[model samples]
Target: MDQLSATLLSAPVLFFILGALAAAARSDLAVPETIAKGMSLYLMAAIGLKGGVEVAKAGFGTELLVALAAGLVLSAAIPFLVAPALARFGGLDRTNTGAVAAHYGSVSVVTFVTASEVYGNTGFAIAGFMVAVLAMMETPAILSGLFLARQKGGRLFAPELLREVLFNGSVVLLLGSFAIGALLGERGFEPISPLFRAGFTGVLCLFLLDMGLIAMRRILKTRALTWRLALLALVFPVINGAIGVLVGTAIGLDAASAAALGILGASASYIAVPAAMRLSLPQADAGLYLAMSLGVTFPFNIVLGIPLFRWIAESLGGML
Candidate 1:
């Protein structure tokens, strides 16, 4: 409860709420799209570089391998679990169901970034390798989504789509920045540390403010999001996050890493998955998936899900 309160009152979350309210009220307040895109790039690069630097300092270990495997399993398996529910309960057709499922299986990098901030504020040490987990977790759900929505006699992936999914800008920047950071190490990173390290939180606040406005506007404008689908958007994070926490605990992760894993599970991808779906499942309802993921799920995770996952991870760690 204390953690939750603190999170809700934090600068980033408050800015997000402000953005949402402004959008809901139909205010003219807006971030320029180009600036938002630039911020997104900056955030990913900062996250990647820091993660790689940490890995360099600590060196690769079994934890990285184990966490990677667990993340892969979750990303691959979540769509299978979610697609049927969307079909049976939400009454979405095959294409849209698979599309939404792919989102839950994938992750929102902003959500992860926000959670990392929350955890950092709360004094938890997130392992550097989790960024690798983040990078790896982005793609498998895309493949799973493609398989679920594959048209009869159609190839699962067109050459172009495969390229798009594999070399998406986000993935490239993240992985590329990580490699650069690893090469640089702490000493090598020192010269540019002020840029990536010092200004991270403030940039995140602005980015999330933009996100909040975008999300609320999406919800307001989209007709495809039914009540049932909205409810699933709220629910999937809790269930998936719990499973992730349990798996992390079982795998001997520390509390922070376990919670980070839970955060990843709880998040739904708005970036990578949507782009992939656009290419592969062209028939899928973009409005519906975007509304559920960006409008409904993203806010929920930012507000409540981060703290919830942290508590769950801590509880499970204590029990173990």
Candidate 2:
């Protein structure tokens, strides 16, 4: 409970609150768009490089393979589990249901990044290879979503979409940085570590502040979110997160990683998946999907889901 309080009260979270409040109050406070993008780039690169270095130190092994397979399987499978509920409970049509399912299946990088900070500062351990897991988890749900919708384009693989999904800026930056860190190792990172490592938290605070404002704005604009649908938004993360932890634990992941798996399962994507959906499921309702993810799920995961998921993972992982 104390840990939860501390986490909720932390600077980044507080800044997020401030952003929401300011927006609600119609304050003019805002982060410039260009600066926000710069922060995002810096964060992705740092996170990727740091994870790669961890993989380098740890060396490639069975754990890496297991994590990769686990991410892919989870990413692909989550849509199937959730799409039916989305259609029934939310009254969403087939296209919007599949689109929302894709978002839930694909992991949220920010949520994963936040959990990493919590684990590091709070004395729980997270695997570096999880970065690789993070990168791999980004796209499979997209294909799974398309399949569930059973709305393929003229081609099974659209060149433009494949380009978009495979080379999405976020994916490229993270994977590229991870590869670099893997090859360069800790020794090489030493020179630039001061820049990347030291400023991570502050940058995140800024980013999340912007995010809070953006999310609330969506909430303001949303007309499609019904009471039942809103309730489902909160419920999905807890259910899916628990499933993630259990799966991770079963697959020999440490407690922290397992908990992260849970968070990934719970989180709905606002960025990559939304972009792909725009291209692929052209008929889907963007306002409906993005509002639920950015407005409801993102905040819920950071504020409540993180601690709860971690506790579950700790308890279950310890029992093992």
Candidate 3:
């Protein structure tokens, strides 16, 4: 609990909370949209390059394959498990529940980025291939959500689902950059080292500033999120984190890698999934999922879940 509290009060998380507060207070301060977008691109590219460099050093192996496969399975399975419970307990209709559950099952790159920072600060080493794993995990839950929605006869266009799953901005940029980085290898990365390495954390800070503003804005818009929904957001991540830890342990992940996996599982997708939901599940109230995701789950994972998962993973690793 002390660790959790410390994490919650960490500089990045607090800055995010401050951003939320500023938004709640309706402050005029804002990140320019273009600059925000540019920051996102830079972060994605740099992270991809870094991951590629690490992979070059480590070389691809069975652990990477196993982790990737586990990520895909989790991404596909979690939404099916979560949607029904949300529908019954939260009073979300089939379509809305499915949409929301999909986001929960998907990866949040920003949250992953933050977790990596937390791990680094704590002197834990994480796998370089985890970034690729993160990218792979983004879309399968979306596909699952669409399948579940269709089973209920929800009105969704096939093209819209395709676009959402394959062409979403974050998905495209993340995978595209990962491919570029993998192709470039060590020699290529050296020339781009200053661009990808030196500027990474600074760009992340700026992005979080924007995220803080956005989270704050969303919180204000949904001022009275129901206890049921809020509780769902909080509890679901714990459950997901547990599953992640188990998988990570089985795959022989070290403490830091397991913690990072826990963080990924616990984090909800706010950006890509929301955009997809808006297009694919138009009848579903954006307020419910977006609020639960950006407003509730994202903050919870960053402040509380990161440390808690890290501790749990460490304890479990020691026992093993």
Candidate 1 achieves a global lDDT of 0.92
The candidate scoring highest on TM-score is: 1
| Predicted candidate 3 versus true structure: per-residue lDDT over 1-320, tens digit per residue | 76777667666777777787788788987999999989888877777777777787788899889999988998888898788778888888777878889888998888888788767766777788888888888988887887776654545457866877788877778777777777788888788798777777777777887898987788777844788988999999999988898889888887888887888788888878878777777777788888998888887887788888889898899898
- For candidate 2, the TM-score is 0.97
Considering only N, C-alpha and C atoms within 3 Å, which residue pairs clash in candidate 3?
none
Candidate 2 lowest-lDDT run of ten: 148-157
Ranking, TM-score, top scorer first: 1, 2, 3
Query: TM-scores, in order shown?
Result: 0.99, 0.97, 0.93
**Per-residue lDDT of 285 in model 1:** 95
| CA lDDT scores, all candidates in order | 0.92, 0.88, 0.82
For candidate 3, which ten residues in a row score worst on lDDT? 149-158
Backbone steric clashes in candidate 1, count: 0
The regions of model 3 sitting more than 4 angstroms off are 5-10, 151-157
- Model 1 lDDT at residue 21: 98
Candidate 1: stretches off by over 4 Å: none
Q: 1 or 3: which has the higher TM-score?
A: 1
